[model samples]
Target: MKLPKRPKQHILETASYKLFSSKIPDEWIIRDITERDYGIDCYLEMVNDDNELSGDLALIQLKSKDEIEWTNKDTFTHYGVDISTTNYWYQFPIPVFIFIGDISNQKLYFNSVHYTIKRNFDQFVKQTTFPYKFKKSDLFEGKDGVFAFKFHYYYEKYRQQFENELRFFISNLQHYKDFQQLHNNLDYHLGLEDTDQIFFESMHKNFSFLCTYFNIDNPIPKLRDIKKKSREKFGNESHYELYEHDLTEWMEEYEKLTINLIVGMKSFLNGELPYWLRINPTIYNYVNNIGDDGTLPYE
Candidate 1:
């Protein structure tokens, strides 16, 4: 089944934020993350180790598979607008960064907004290219809007790459046997006995986080529903029927993103963590009158 774009982006971003916040310091905060226009989609605010109010701003531009290849240069711009050309980054305290993750093109690029500021200089030739590693501390200093922009740009870029990888796994709906094999392997690796609840519950939590991030009211679709919808759309056919008359541009994008979401979730279920815990570690440890040996009673 196809997944929607807004929710897919939300899940990916939320997951990354969760991981980053967990791994990183508590003072650094992620705020105002959204699909908002021209403005920065996500912001990081905190007092740096130097005790400065170091803040970062970033814009995220999403590209579908086809758009990834066909998109013009503007697609690479932060917030879908050229800050360097317009010198908008300098207008605000928050620095600007642009992140582009193109799954179809398999390209991930990050560029600083200051590329515009220095582009007119003789030594500015190097600003045109994307950088693999950016120094965050250097950018966070002063009112240097470029640093925050680049920070967000890289963060969203990583977010998009992760979403694409998860989506790829989610799109292969016909591969249940592969999922089963993965499930078995994870169960074995985790030394799990009852795998069903752990498998589904951890997934449920992950999906719930994604849904919350996107503000999606109906995030978790039943697997049976996915199969039903898949049959309706593809049937015995190998490809989806794309008719201009049947769906709007936005609808088509939403459908595809939704499909990706489903596929990604299924892929996530067969991972090691859920299989190890059997989705009931909390119940096993904290709750009394639990079943023997960590396996849930029904499982």
Candidate 2:
């Protein structure tokens, strides 16, 4: 399996689980898994204190995307495919842990639209009902259940491109350290923790139009209005006033996010992701061959 490099948040979450597992005795087996064919990325095995395989399996669903908007279809389909696959070890009710980026601020509306998925799933699993019950609750329903959704939300607008172009850029970004570094620095400076403060406090859903065209969570703010207001309040130092008055000590935050984005784009040009994530192999190869000018068949 060609293991692609995931985001910092995913790495952190995975590491935490590993650390937690280390406390367990060796009789309890813990292993990192990457089930690509099933869309089941990485997870750990939890053994009992008695060093017996008590038929317990813990799965962590990790998603690394450039956009904050995640639809019901994406989650259902990804996990549905994974769970639908026959796995004797995972036959028992397993716990799915979702580690998402930008969870600190964003209250994901999973239930509002997840009904559509649940209804479809009921039909899909009609013939077969596992012992565990399907959840109809909000995004974070705690129980020994199947399918947990999560991601690390980022708003890097400078690398915005058409959806197809952006997809290629993201896939190719796997190998680039500079791009990875930029992401790390951005997370550090922006305080990318507590999904609520990072997503719920701002205009999250309003950027769908931008995402459609730009492939990102970047929205053009009312800078002209801000400039005028700054001029009136601070007089002459208005350009600097935007930072001084609006954010106070947020300059470092703004600078890091902005510079990271700028650096990320440069890294993409250097072939960071290695391969763009393909819905299928044909599409993957077709896009990968496209040259810098966006024309296909690089050679």
Candidate 3:
């Protein structure tokens, strides 16, 4: 009797799966569905530390390479594929992440396939076997549950209905209470921290729409500048050391600006949110109507 033989393809793919399994939190579950023969190789479901399913899920398309190199210096990683395959990936209801593992050094690089379509659809459609670039920053850092949290955030956004965009916009503005607390607490800014960098990024992620909502100058940059200086002096050694840079001139102004933003947020939270929900046109009206009806048509 003859026995079945394993091909090089099987060994390579199995190695890739093993690498991915190691990076994820042990609490998470990876269901291998490669036999299904669709584009997806696995369904990754996250389990929260509380030992319960977090209901966070994503589709994975795994590709393996040894010693992955950046296509353009360290800017980004580009992978080429036929337009039809991208067209196929775009149809998924949920997010599809193209996870490329560098088996040699044990690093994983990933980017959302749909994100490519959404960002460069026009040019993308015009070509075939296009090299889609993925952000270098998105490479797995191998620690901190940041990737898991970010996965859920993007997945949640994908599941939201188009009608919820405005509500999301309002929601982003209504929630600065946590930051406001830090703004008032002077001791917290003694040194630079990861959260400080994240704050600057998160605060300004929606800045284009934010400009329409809040007209104040962005204070995040100044704080981030302070953070950089602290990093220069102290490195990531600690988050509580005294900053060499003086905070006297900007602290109060920064607090006041933050408070004003809070005030604006409150105004929108109490005012626009309800209006957006039910849309009482009168509250948003600028024209005044007179019972006499005999004057100029406009206010």
Candidate 4:
């Protein structure tokens, strides 16, 4: 009598589990979801060398096939998924990964659903085919037969993009004389309330981007501090007066601090120093001296 062959899905899942376990034995704990899962096959937890959980978790949707159709040199078009399924994955608080395994080639490719949503919003439309391409090596780093996934690794990989965007925005503020101009009229024509509101909104947007990029917790206090200091020096003057009096100085100072922060982060990512030591000394001192609960020391 011959035994029944294993199901295709079971074979794929087993192969994926084996690959993950073998590649990242030291840094990840893979848990198979036995029950009927909603587009998720497994949960992976970031772990330390001692097998202690690092509190970072990710949901993975696995797809395995003998071959995948490559739409182009750098892109693969996969089967379409329903909008509801995509939305469900999008709503995950933690990161979500879609892993594709080429069983014939013995290779694996993965992409982040979060990043996809950020970069390609149209892909989430109902009945749209999923495109898989960009391979982020930072998602899985291995050395000396040990592989691990860390949150900082992902952030560091994209730090340059964040820095470039921020630098461009700040540089425009420095060179554009009409940075405060809302319409064709000069800054003086704008009411104080309107000026304050516009500047605050812009600053808030930029600061929010920085905090999200760096995964900073409680960044509002720092933003408030910058605004408070500018207000104190510039006073409730005309928009032009505020710009000329102190806002310009504040922007210049902020640009410098941003550059320093990016440089320090780069160094830290390169293994020169730990994350705690990567903070700009001036900001670190300010946060420390102010005894602010918002800016907690990095863990």
Q: Which candidate number has the best lDDT?
A: 3
TM-score of 2: 0.22
- Candidate 4 residue lDDT tens string, 46-92: 66667777676778787766765554455675654556677888777
- Predictions: Cα RMSD each: 22.9, 20.5, 14.9, 15.1
| Number of the candidate with higher lDDT, 2 or 4 | 4
User: In candidate 2, how many Å is residue 149 off?
Assistant: 11
Candidate 2 per-residue C-alpha lDDT over 77-181 given as tens digits, one digit per residue, 9 for 90 to 100: 223233353233234234443333223332222221122222244333444532222232334322211122222111211223333454544343322223233
Model 3, stretches more than 4 Å misplaced?
1-7, 34-36, 148-156, 167-299
Full-model lDDT for every candidate: 0.38, 0.36, 0.56, 0.53
Sorted by TM-score (best first), the order is 3, 4, 1, 2
Please give me the total number of clashing residue pairs in predicted model 1: 20
Q: Candidate 1's C-alpha lDDT? A: 0.38
lDDT tens per residue, model 3, 1-299? 99999986677678888888888777878887736456688988866659798776778878877766776656554555667767777777777777777788887767777655544545565656656675556676555435643553364344334224334433443343344445454553454355654654455444323433444566544445655666676667775433423243344554455445444434443433333334433322311221122121242
**Each prediction's TM-score versus the true structure:** 0.25, 0.22, 0.51, 0.49
Clashing residue pairs in all predictions, respectively, total: 20, 24, 0, 0
- Candidate 1, residue 53: lDDT: 67
